[model samples]
Target: MSTPLRLSTVILPVRRWHEGGRRSWERAEDLGFHAAYSYDHLSWRSFRDTTWFGAIPTLTAAATVTERLRLGTLVTSPNFRHPVTLAKELITLDDISGGRLTLGIGAGGSGFDATALGREAWTPRERADRFAEFVPLLDRLLTEDAVTHRGTHYSADEARNIPGCVQRPRLPFAVAATGPRGMRLAAEYGQAWVTTGDPRLSEAGTPRQSRDAIRDQIERLGKACADLGRDPDTLDKVLLTGFTPDKNDPLRSVDAFVDFAGRHAELGITEIVVHEPVPGTVFAADESVYERIATEALPRLG
Candidate 1:
């Protein structure tokens, strides 16, 4: 048995924060996306111009413009910031978002980022082990009145976090795990499993890549939860689909739109976040992603 999954997609809020992360966010809100998200990268290779200034700042700016949408970092790495500091920032953003914040996290393992952070890029298993410990600890700190935690990687001395999560106990947490260990973490600790669609081996394109692999990942995620003595069906699942349509050009037909969403739906992906990249900013491709999204993708997904 697996948890009931609904629509959730991580869209590129902006190509780069400094350039137009704010402007892209306005489109996401207008499109009625359930949850909007941005990638966290200190250094980007393919698109050097696009860099992560700070996901929280961009999300905070989004909070001011929209009220109904939920915002999160597609996957913020754990190595860059201290645990307490990260917790505090998320808490503040939680308040700013009016309780519509989902915290998606992962390990920093890219060559450039790992070296820059001074944290060794551990293997998948090691990263999973750390996340398994960290996610729950963070969850407790944000949800409980006070937290006394001690683990292999972190220790807290009678931590008392103020203004606990504004959301219910289920302060949405997305673990963007693509491996087995990550799958287990998502099941045991994550409120939802966040996935970037199927990526091609060729690294020359935008992250607007996806495939039916989501079904397999979702199944793996379910089994992981079951192993932890938890009901897989009790968890929440969100899958992100990168939708790039031609704006002024449009998708040609409504049936085409249905076909696109239906493919994801058939694959057990209920919710999708349409990522629109900022032109001449973070995205090296084209600016049409935004217009195509508003006219074709969002309307159909909505």
Candidate 2:
């Protein structure tokens, strides 16, 4: 049987909790989204000048107001975070959320976050190297009582997580990657694999090309799993919309999304996460159309 398609949303941390953030999350749950994620960045592009909030605190606050909606970072990174500290926060967040937290992690990018900590940004190779160490160390930190590790990029000494994650063997990791090394990590450690299609083609590529790119990515993920003697089908494939060539087409109307989703679903995507319309920003869309996609289009997928 094919995996059932799940719909989710990413609510950027641009709104203050009292103002509208809380309502957005509550509405997402009411709308029946499988999960609601926020960007785990210190400050994202364009929105950097606005009221950007921290991902951890935002999700933690959302947890209090939500009951069943799974909360998580769209893709947290080691950019300015250490495994030791992040794991502690994640454990608390998971417990508070009643084991309804997923950690969407990646190798991170060299944008604002890379230099926000007052340090030189890492090269692509360096970022990949750090990511390799970050995931395993984080895994151990969330699962073990005390961890001691020494690595080239990060280190922890007898770090203690008194009570481990609420989720057994630690909360699920939805690793974001489109490269070989990263795919290997996802196969080895991730419960889900995330992709945003191809960045190179985000601006100039056609929808067909974007789908082809994702198809290739899924194929690579399968091979990585095969090399590790693991089943590729075991990992959930997630596509975070907007970065693909399809862009806002999926949000233009219910039928557009249904069509866009059906095409990607054929490529093995189990979950599709669309951004909640933030007018005037790159994520701008028709809110009513977006809601229709949630309330109307999703059921049609089944």
Candidate 3:
């Protein structure tokens, strides 16, 4: 049987505090969201000069405040992480969250974060190769103890993972991949494959065009899984929608949200994540929209 569609939302930690963050996550839990996530970037594009918290610390805080909502990074990357250290940090987080942790990883994108920390900018191909190495090494370090390895992009010498993760054999990975190499890696190792859908879907395209683009991506993922002799059904297909709080947002209306989810289900997507507006402020002054989703749109989608 197909798995039921799961819903998650991303709460960007720009210009926010602990109490505010706690309130936001708690509200999501109360709203019956399956999971909540934060972005892992040093400085995001739009809010480069604003206050921002580290993804891990924010997530740890979120996990502590919420009892049932799963916590995750929208997509953490190798931009500034050493796989070995990152592995240890994630394992500790998994323990703290009592196993309600999902690791969302992606290839480092080019932007402010690419050159912010005195690091040289990497080309697209280089970033892809680094990501390819990072995921497998991280997987090994999380699952096996005393991992020692060397790769083109990273290295670990007798790295020991003691008092391992709460989730056996490592926590679930939600890998973001929109390319062939990334899709294959997701098929081989991720519990979920995540995409923002094709950019064209959001740019100069209608709803039907958006759905068609997603279907094409889904078919590509299926073929990648087949090539690796893995069942595509085993991976949760996650689509990220609703970037803004306007008509552009898929969750802007209850009917539109339901239709969007139904189309994703028809395309074999098992999960959908939306971007939540800044909580506890004028930007997100109306919490009714969220409540409506919990009481109306969500039930219909299910």
lDDT: which candidate is best? Answer: 2
List candidate 1 stretches off by more than 4 Å. 1-19, 49-52, 197-212, 228-234, 242-257, 280-289, 295-302
What does candidate 2's lDDT look like per residue over 1-302, in tens digits? 88999999999999878899899999999989999999999999898888999999999999999999999998999999999999999999999999999999999998999999999999999999999999999999999999999899889999999799989989999999999999999999999999999999999999999999999999999999999999999999999999998888889989889999999999999999999999999999999998888899877987
| Selected candidate, larger TM-score, 1 vs 2 | 2
Instruction: State model 3's lDDT.
Output: 0.82
Off by over 4 Å in 3: 243-247, 279-286
Clashing pairs in 2: none
How do the candidates rank by lDDT, highest first?
2, 3, 1
Q: Give the TM-score comparing model 1 with the true structure, all chains together.
A: 0.79
Indicate the worst ten consecutive residues by lDDT in candidate 1: 243-252
Model 3, span 46-162: residue lDDT tens: 567767789998888787877899999888998888899999999999988999999999997887778988878899999999999999999999998889898887999999998
Candidate 2 or 3, higher lDDT? 2
Native-referenced Cα lDDT, model 1: 0.64
| Ranked by TM-score, top first | 2, 3, 1
Give the whole-model CA lDDT for all candidates, comma-separated: 0.64, 0.95, 0.82
